[model samples]
Target: MPDYEPIVGRYLTIEVAGEACRIHVEEAGDGIPLVCLHTAGSDARQYRHLMCDPAITDHYRVIAFDMPWHGKSNPPVGWRDREYSLTTELYKDTIMAFCRAMELRHPVIMGCSMGGRVVLHLALEQADRFRAVIALEGADRLEPYYELDWLHRPDIHGGEVCAAIVSAQVAPQSPDEYRWETLWSYMQGGPGIFKGDLYFYWYDGHFDDRSPLIDTDKCPVYLLSGEYDSSCTPERTAATASRIAGAKATVMEGIGHFPMSENPALFRTYILPVLDEIRGAG
Candidate 1:
């Protein structure tokens, strides 16, 4: 809905472990560098509204990128799952490797949903590289409703289930446009990408008790939540944040899972300031 200048985001290839993964990084604005990670199946376009905002640009530089199998990145052709879990490990390595490649030391990392999960992993694994982290609408565990007897729920699709749950959170404004874009972008990932991501969701146990790995004292952590987030409820997110020392938690009222998309104005007003505060502290 927002018109942005057609600036070409840079593409670079980084090797994670042994697999070559593609990354797209957009550098804009001024001041401290803020690296934003996109949610699962979402690309850098998720932060388009934020990137377009001069308020954020005036204070800090925004760097956003797409993951290996999302957006402009290509997926492995005819890739099938063996027993390898591709949920957290791939993203964790990719983000860390990207920072190492780009020489982004101690960046303020912020992410939403799956992106938030990735941030959590990074904070736990490489706390020194990140000054602060804000995990919005994210949890260390999968949505209980989605994992209700995962062994017997062959009829349920996590992607469809998540979409339906998030749909209920946004009211008044219709998701017709969002729905179309999501499906279009998701399907653009092709069959292999879909299979890999879904397989991770179905079989991986990455969400189980990651708090032990988190070092809240060393890295200031924050968990932000929309009041109506159906996927990760405010209570759940807050509880996860509370488990870590000095981790802050806030429940944003009158918003949904993707508050930045649903209400960009409110996000700029309520959320952007948090980034500013963290930047100042840094």
Candidate 2:
């Protein structure tokens, strides 16, 4: 066996949603485009492995971007006066705008958590626009929205507090190294962004018995849940998948929320076959 070295990823600024969002963008390999959407509060940096891994980049022009308020991106104008709040409308608009601005023709989209929740909207609203969608820890409706009214209190470090909440959700079986890496993102988010994202993830994102709106004919939809994710259980994801025609669902064992970064090596084992299936579909 030999040491594996990853190709360096690019850091670029891409304009999106009528703002000069100085976002971090990474791209590698060349085939069909694969646009990755990160979890709330986290950045494109989460997909560093996928951007660097030849196994995936070899077959797709993989790209990931940090939202304007997250990662290395600059906040849009007027953002300095108020707290950052992500809405369902803005979320989908930004995603759609990004792909169009980048000219990513029929790109395969993959997202987790809040990103996962919005991906369902993308599939239902514009299936012909994308080749396929992979939603990790995804569900039609994310429930039991939490209230962290004290998140902005002077004594509270909202980012750290949010991280602690997620730490409780990390699967016990995940490797120590993987577990910590995933939790690190939560600690790094901008003030109040994590809680704001939850407004959409846990509350406004609900589709409410509307999973049937997703048409697998125009675009293939695959929903994957980590075995230990209590937020969006595997059973919940499967039941949602069952409502959509031609959709498929699977539970990745020994994993939890944030599967991609929590355990990239293990998560890849589950994703490879789906990539092949998408390739065959093309």
**Winning model by lDDT:** 2
* Candidate 1 regions with alpha-carbon error over 4 angstroms: 1-7, 77-85, 144-166, 169-189, 192-208
Prediction RMSDs, each to the true structure: 4.3, 2.5
**Model 1 pairs in collision:** none
Question: How well is each residue in 204-236 modelled by candidate 2, as lDDT tens digits?
Answer: 788646669787888899998999998888888
In angstroms, the error of model 1 at 162 is 7.4
Relative to the unseen true structure, what is the Cα RMSD of model 2?
Answer: 2.5
State every prediction's TM-score relative to the real structure.
0.81, 0.93
How much is 64 displaced in model 2, in angstroms?
0.9
TM-score of predicted structure 2: 0.93
- Candidate 1, residues 150-240, lDDT tens digits: the string is 3223575544544444456553342556544543444344333434453443345255477656887777788888887776688778777
